[model samples]
Target: METHDSLLARIAPAPGQCSRTILDPATGTPVGEAPVHTVEDLEAAVAAAAAAQPAWAALGHDARSAALLKAADAVERSAEELARLLSREQGKPLNGPNARFEVGACAAWLRATATTPLDPETVVDDGETRAELHYRPIGVVGAIGPWNWPMMITTWQIAPALRMGNTVVVKPSEYTPLSVLALTAVINEELPEGLLTVISGGPDVGEALASHPAIGKVMFTGSTATGKAIIRSSADTVKRLTLELGGNDAGIVLPDADPKAIAQDLFWGAFINTGQTCAALKRLYVHDSLYDAVCEELAAVAAAMPMGNGLDENNVLGPLQNQQQYDILARLVDAARDAGARILLGGNPDPGQPGNFYPTTLVADIDNNNPLVTEEQFGPALPIIRYTTIDQAIAMANALDVGLGASVWSPDVSAAREVAARLQAGTVWINKHGAVDPRIPFGGAKQSGYGLEFGTEGLKALGQPQIINGWTATQTRATPN
Candidate 1:
């Protein structure tokens, strides 16, 4: 029930603190001021987290789970305010799979992370010896989040770390700090002081957070370049890392797929969040037999989705989050046009537009090696490549150094599974793309990044594993000569 101004005021920086004005991506207007914390601030946060860790871990699993449940309720109570703030700051509309969906996902992941069990397991149990494996708290964890889904990704990083009994210090992206600050404020209502904190600073602060000696682990979701930088910084400390980096995911369409039947799903797969998703389908490969038909169907679906300011309820799609991203998308689309690729729809934008609004573009008859197809556009431009054989499609798909996700679309489930098996991605969807689940483990292969998040595997990643081995009292030990 909080009003927009009241919610913004709650997360505003203190009167004298150094801060930066966050701009609305849909319109070049100030959303709110995010406090610019420095390396000193990061040190204090980490110190506090390190100091608070042992007591939190001693509370045991049930108490922590109960606290997380209350935090989830807190998120629900402030859901509307968080969604509206996210829409303004991140440039995703309130409708569709944008702001509201991201906020709802935050609460869902909290509840899921709270209840998922990780009981001690007896790895080896013979009559003579028994060995059990258990996970212990890693103390302090540092979380670095990206801008595209700021609030939800923050939840993804923090929930498991807290559930595993580690205190977390978050460093949100410079582009979307207000959303994260507001979100953590809501969740912190039910959490103890110093249990969770957000440091909204520049790259220097991020570097400090990753390399700080007090932090035992770091969970990051950002570019491959930043992920590599984090690895180098953490080398001295040998911090445990969970990195979800950049991905130029691909999707393959079999000749048997019905173009009209799957067009809607295909459109959303590539254009979700204006195509800012890390695991979104960027390059699509369709069999030559149905290439033209698939392109036409997808183009028809893309042309109908409304794009405007995020405050507008009817506009499901919004502007690119920043001008740099908009320029990257425009340059790639223009290069495709110069290469004589067929533009099925939307390759141009009005220069007079107020915000960074690039049109939804679909390029067909494009070569597999074209930059738009080869590189990660990270926008609402999809390059469709045609292939005569499944092997050729699979080869192009696997050729990329980064493989986070991919999909195979076919009417026959069995056939789709066969094609999917040949893909080198971390997750291969049979008839869809980027349908991440809280219960299923998600990560990347190759240069896309390392480690896993979500489910039981995710919980284990946040903690340190220990083995307890002992001999049974009934067993008699033999003497060695």
Candidate 2:
């Protein structure tokens, strides 16, 4: 594998920071490099953003909308190259970025942001006094993203901030910087320099950006451990926060469902990107009556799928992103097996292929005490815990602190809807898994993090609503226009 640092020379530049080489996750190769910002760099980026913000916001509806439409066009033009870079950096499998799902969604989102308004409207009216509400941009946003779903996550942060008329300075995880850098370049051609910036590096940079004075809001998506750190740093300014943290999401299979059908849904839910997704179904509770059948079908599917680097379109699973994830997966598998959980399919890393990746793992009879059942595994391992009733299943599923996403499997749409409604997750699917639409609001509840990130609610999350308690045409709107 070529040294990942090799790509440092040609990738792209951060608006006000130094750049670094970003490595490829597939083979530890360097596909390219990106700017790596420092505390000073973060501050500089924020300053630039603050200086440029008012003008961008002043551009208002039409001008901003036109620019964003240009961004959508750029995304469409570079879709293929972007997908290849996304797969190499993020370790998603065959369908990976090729799904074109997030790409198209972003184009639609950016355009939507361009047109949405935050102006004051008359709510209650009388002769001389009137009351109204006004929505305004919050200012410069410091957006920190995770390793999974780089392009989509970037849009989640940027579109809202831009749409609401605030500028953004983003920090992509150290693991997958190239993809973010590639994405920023596409946006750069459409907007001014400081409007959307990307910065890469580790802890120092993240803390630096989060706490910077010029940043008005800090939005983050990553592990719970790091999220705490970021929160602590942002305290000085009390910067507004939006966090989409880790999820040990659960999938419940009702007794009335067909095992084969549920098994298929759970496969993509659990093993997509080799299960590196934040909200990917990590813990599963199958109805006791269908336990054995569900296990059999899931194992057969896992064993049948091809695993390799994502460069080939035929591969269903790709290499894990790095050594740390590899070690974590191995430990989880071993621990589950030791706890007497039945390993029906892939349980360990493939030694024949020397890379940072694992196969789809399905374990049965895993107890709640097991961390694999309680914690967010964030890997390809799926521990199927059996339950007897809907109440028991729901109880077990809601038992974890991370409530990012969940799915209720049943051919019965009515039953699925009922179970899904009761789930304490940000997003829930019925009879289907890992299926997301651009129009639906996405994000998690509780420890998984607060704040919504898509659709209309998501667009609204980026806005500030001001109550016009006492108003005249001129005595009102003390707030800046």
Candidate 3:
């Protein structure tokens, strides 16, 4: 089959056609284009992954480890080029922590999954009989990733699948297809054919991939609405699934917290990646004692932030991925202000800036009933609500349906730990925010979606348990007697 030249690829295809374009969010230019795969393309990719899985699974741990290590090397070598493309495609900070952190996640996850063995062991060892357990690879895995974390999240899905000896078919978000392809290209150079594959396109392709009969499992990271849709579509086949969905992660600023520290943590937690992160901080509940100080500190930082194209080295804030988000963010801010919330610092679009970039907007006095409080604003806006008591603060924080992640701001370690225990979330940080570990599981509870990614949990997510009957020669002799 002939492949189209990358330069001539179309962004969006005509109705049924499989084509797409990559928008440079910085200047509103066509950065690049790639094929928008169709339902048929989804079928083909699924078929390819299904057919390739058995052989890949048979390779055992050592061979797979070598491939993963090679892929890690490739990623490290291409980090610069990948970061540039990611920054342009995703409109993130030019060579800053976000891009570098993503690349580091890829390297870390791949190497860790490959090197760490998901060893199956013997369960019972009686004198008469023994039972041993073994893990077999689940068949083809369908991975649907999100735009907020196109590259790193995909690696979380793909690396573990490969490590567990499974083949993968990835469906990346349309907005940031280039980074996924770039990552895939690196893997293709290191791994064998069909071990990993990528299909980029729109919603139909995603539905097709989700419903494909050959796909044994699906690991999805997107919104709760779409995760529900995926669950419904795959109900007929009963495909094994792991969904890491939406989040309205709240941060609790205790009476004992420092204002300046809370302000800086709040800035990065909410404003990082222009607030296009699922786990980004959206809600803040502050104790009345420190509420005024926290508000002032957050506004002081927000006022100092410089918004510009991600390509600019000096830029700290970049564009929101699309126009709908731009409008929604602005509207949310306005609604919060209209609903009696105090506008501490930011509340509008920066008229002088190019692209869909918005300033780091901060609002205060928002209540749980407000839409800004309930919904996930995937932008650089943080709503701070004051609470008179710790009980009131916890109550307000738990009001949202999403329980993806939460952070507690307190100078007291014991208090932070106590709060972290009761908070309804998959992961919670104490006195620190957005801290993640590769060796630990990362995911959410409630409407945030079920299942985990990374570490031993990720490997377990891709395996099937089996009992092997065994008996030593002496045990067999004794049983005969």
Candidate 4:
């Protein structure tokens, strides 16, 4: 395993700025330090990507795909080492359904993206007229990745851009930049110099990248407020953007769903990654008939699962990645409790604990207006609201301004499919929550931000369409001469 010191060296902060300590969220201890980059450093990285992009684009899909496949191999080889760093920094358990899973996913996504192709299409073909549409790479993609699932999300943003022929300057979330930088180093070994680079810092670096004149596009994953700021910043350049912003994803359980059978799936759906996921089942609306049983079964399942330091292999969950998020969750839970919401399990914070540990909390009987239900907690807490009718449930689910993902749970697949179709989310699942496939496209609808990620549509979003038309020689001569 690479030492924290060695990994720290991989991050490039600006020359004058001091390094910032990265904490192990599992123990609240110092994991390593990441450099705090300045606007100048961000600009330099952008410039380097801009310089390398044309050549990268010239290499075409075959060569770029080959390089990405090699990077995937490196990621697989370093999976163990990267998973440990990921566990410490990102606060996900090292095994089971957490850090290792994310590492494996990173490699899988890279391979999938490497194989996915965007071939030019003939829009029109006749004897005298022929038009072809080509997906051309946009230069210098500034990828600002979020802290939650940093490795996989970063891979989601950059791999496609790189595979589609654009060079990237990535600035990972300050709280979880270590694993990203480390993973970047592994991928960089197979990539050309300046083709992919990492700049570690806070909002300033992100702002600089978003507003920079030379950056052709900005691909961001975070809050809606921040996404809007990026939109405003990118206006001057009219840069292409893919913003996968905040999601208050809702999961509706039909009266027909067997509460006992779906209990485990429901528990993991909401609490996976300690409920830090953007598309995690945040608010659950259950038909009133199954509401109490669903709550009881979900609470039982959640209570049985172990939550502790992420390094322990037996633990399935870990701490919140940072204090800011922890406090936000704490306040929301407190407000819900004060409003007479029944806390089925794990509502309070363990203030004496070394880590930012909030137990897997489930609140029952909360109305749609409850703060916990209304806001995006983005932590290990779920508010289970009871609804009398499917119409009511659907109405409540779509009421939120953000719509990244939603799910319908029922025994009848056909019935579930009917309900799923009405969901306002980008990705709606039946009997499942946040299952994403490389072959399927995923993105937000409404205020959750625009553009798709994953699949062919996602690959196409990283590029611009250029149409070439062939005209008859006689027609051209008559017009010109």
Give TM-scores for every candidate, taking all chains together and pairing residue i with residue i: 0.99, 0.90, 0.93, 0.96
TM-score for candidate 1, please give it. Answer: 0.99
What is the Å distance of residue 403 in model 2 from its true position? 1.2
Model 3 pairs in collision: 10-20, 11-20, 11-21, 18-36, 19-36, 319-357
Question: Compared with the true structure, what per-residue lDDT tens digits does model 2 show for residues 1-481?
Answer: 2222323333666466565665555677776656666677667778889999999989875677788888988877776666666777776653643324445656767766665544567888875577887767888998998877777888878987887788999898887888777777778889987888776767898888888877878889988888888789999998888888988888898888888866766788888767878878888888888899999998988888887777678876777777888888788889989989888888866676656777678888889779778767777789988888899889888887778889988878897899999999988888766676556778888888888876666666776777777766655445776
**Stretches of model 4 off by over 4 angstroms after superposition:** 1-6, 9-17, 472-481
Tell me, what's the RMSD of every candidate? 1.1, 4.2, 3.5, 1.8
Candidate topping TM-score: 1
- Candidate 3 residue 290 C-alpha distance from true site, Å: 0.8
Shift of residue 452 alpha carbon in model 2, Å: 1.4
**What tens-digit string does per-residue lDDT give for candidate 3 at 95-158?**
4456767887788888988887677786888776788888789999999998876889899899
In model 4, what are the clashing residue pairs, if there are any? none
lDDT of 3 at 434: 66
RMSD (Cα, Å) of model 3: 3.5
How much lDDT does each candidate structure score?
A: 0.94, 0.78, 0.82, 0.90
Residue by residue across 67-142, what tens digits does model 4's lDDT show?
A: 9999999898888888888998998998767999999999999999999868889988776777899898888889
Off by over 4 Å in 2: 1-21, 94-105, 115-122, 126-129, 471-481
Report how far off residue 108 is in candidate 4 (Å). Answer: 0.5
Considering summed lDDT, which 10 consecutive residues are worst modelled in model 4? 472-481
Candidate 4, residue 96: CA error in Å? Answer: 2.5
